[model samples]
Target: MTTVLERSPGSEAPPPSSSPLTTDARGRRRKATDVTMRVLVTAAFLVALIPLISLLYEVISRGVRMLSWEFLSTDMQGVFGDMTSGGILHALLGTVQITALATLISAPIGLLAAIYLVEYGKGRLARVLTFFVDVMTGIPSIVAGLFAVALFALLVGPDYRSGLMGAIALSVLMIPVVVRSCEEMLKLVPNELREAAYALGVPKWLTIVKVVLRTSLAGIVTSIVLAIARVIGETAPLLLTVGIVTQVNTNMLDGRVATLPVFAYSQYSQDALGVGADRAWGAAFVLIVLIMLLNLVARFISRRFSIAER
Candidate 1:
């Protein structure tokens, strides 16, 4: 049986509680623990942020001096070490072309695979594919570069370093990320949307295309952006597959090409106190700016699509 307590008519009401919680010992201990965890989490966040802030500061402070208009439009075709007059136009273009190619190659394949996994996968084949993708995700990037080189060498002679090869290598790194990220995004689409479309007698494929993909379009674009960023900053793969060039070459199937990461690596290779070091820092800054611009583009696309969806 439940027991009830009664209050006397002449007695004053109990004092207001000191907190949202009761003032018992257990409550007090729980509040103390909550405060302790909040303090620790805040401290950890600040600690993690310190390195990022320091890195940005150092890069911007050092790089801004050399990141002039001329520095962005010229290449070191005839210029030698320690001069640092040429721009990185060729390298910049190569980076854009190669990365775009990689994105083109990986995005569709990954998206389709993710669609299959989310919409139709239900058997052992899906599990095996997922396991392999997980394996690929952890594979060292250099291994991808090597595999690309070997594959191309078998088909196109032993000396096969090209922008196309670099893109292929980068695609190997990007596909798994695209698949995983797109899978998560696709999963976020509400089942109600799918069911409602199906109840309207919509074809399964049409429902997925119109309802599922459209609903998750924003997240899909964001995932692509993430995949691009993840691969754009990698150096080892490009170094082996793309090599380096001082001249402009827009052809992906042709000779050596330069990219921002490779450009920065080449610049940093010069003597410690030389102008090359400064140029390297500038290249790094430009790279960061390019990434920021790409992110802006992705955000714009997402917002535009979201508005249309609305």
Candidate 2:
């Protein structure tokens, strides 16, 4: 009878009630933390947006009226006037060519370097490569230009200024950015996946080629686009190396290139501010649009590729 005092098999005592003041204090603290976090996030976003908003406002206010097809399509060869002047066609073309060439050179090297760093690299050489990449990252754009100028002086003589030189300088600037970005993206691919590929008896090279690269291809492409954007607006390198011209020169190996940034600099530096200033603003507008388009295209491509992977 003493052992037959029935009790529920799994039931437990209820948790003790917390004091009302303590409960209220905890609730208030949670609310306060939430409010503080919201305030901080809002402030951070505003701070981030202010510069971009200001730039867009200024560019639009000054250059909206100049946004005609004639202004963008016709080359500003000989025309000069006040507030109503020539176009940025040649500079636009040169900027495109120069950035394209730079991307062509940098993207491959950067992607390969990233692959080696993340996949094949394991020892002191990897560490050295990482250190060098870090140093390159901090090197000024002007220094890259100077390096290109100095290097070319030995090979092509003192008067050697070509779009190819400009591209090489830009490649120097772009490679580090691409390497860092692609390396990060590649690192995000799980070691578990790599191991699974290895478990399946796949060779390391094939695993990297078939699984690693494909998985990270979208990010690699985005990194390439971002690197292109980084160098597209460069002025100093083009100024020192390519030299500016009013006319179009398509050959990257020899002759003056008319990139948008250098074109803007030339226009603004002219003795008079009438037509030159106007054209400079217009070129700036075009450059902005082109960068914007590139970013959009990158996002689109990344999205499409990501969806396809899924």
Candidate 3:
């Protein structure tokens, strides 16, 4: 006997199967969205790149003519008026000396402080120290310069202007940056490594030195380089503390010194239309090159020396 199956009265028709047309439409929408996002991101990148390309073009076009062995070797001691018979030797020397001094002064202190904050710090003291570091990070470069000037003036004399003082000012700026960057880098280290070191009966300090610091060494170096770049181009602080001199003076305490930024400013201010302007542009080009070299060196060091996982 043949039996007829009956459907319930309240039962609705089964849902239709998904169609290829609907699936294709949804895939097309996704593709369209992805394409739109790519276009937007590319447009943004090109817009950001425009200014940098323009700046490089302007600097290179104007400054390339003035860059020479003579421009790199000679000092502006006797080159008076629009003579244009001088180079940035003195400024370059001062920039190197003062920045090196500042690094020497700030690096150890900042690293130690960061270590303390990250490893051993607890409770109210750590909070206070962190707060102070945060405040210092936002302190104006001019204020640091003034503080250095005032400190030296009170200790030595009112008219004391030297590269040492400029170094001190830069140290103030560098310290906060170093501390903050180092703190973040140290924090990025895994706690598992610390625990493993502890499980092996290693002392806390030894573990930090061997495991934590080693793991973060590359980042720490990068942070230090960034701090150097931040302070190297500062004109106001160096101008106030180091002052400008035509001849090279290597003594940090005896007399004024010239830095690239200060020298560029002085040249442009003194002679905007002639040889000085070209010299100023050339100094700027040199400064940019120096920063680029420092970054490259940092990258090399990071790659060569940083701990690698097996």
lDDT of each: 0.91, 0.88, 0.94
RMSD of each: 2.9, 3.7, 4.6
Off by over 4 Å in 3: 1-34
Candidate 2 residue-wise lDDT at 122: 88
lDDT, residue 154, model 2: 96
TM-score for each prediction?
0.93, 0.88, 0.89
Model 2: per-residue Cα lDDT over 1-310, one tens digit each: 3667666989877999977644798777887898999999999999999999999988777767678988878776786555355677889889999899988899999999999999989899999999999999999899999999999999889999899999999999999999999999999888988999999999999999988988888998899998888889999989999878867788989998888999888888983456677677777888888989999999988888873657
Candidate 1 backbone collisions, by pair = 74-87
Give the candidate order by descending lDDT.
3, 1, 2
User: Which pairs clash in the backbone of model 3?
Assistant: none
lDDT of 1 at 171: 98
Count of residue pairs whose backbone atoms collide, per candidate: 1, 1, 0
Better of 2 and 3 by TM-score: 3
| lDDT for each residue of candidate 1 in 112-136, tens digit (9 for 90 to 100) | 9999999999899999989998999
Q: Give me the candidate number with maximum lDDT.
A: 3
Lowest summed lDDT across 10 adjacent residues in model 2 is found at: 76-85
Highest TM-score: which candidate?
Answer: 1
lDDT of 2: 0.88
What TM-score does candidate 3 reach? 0.89
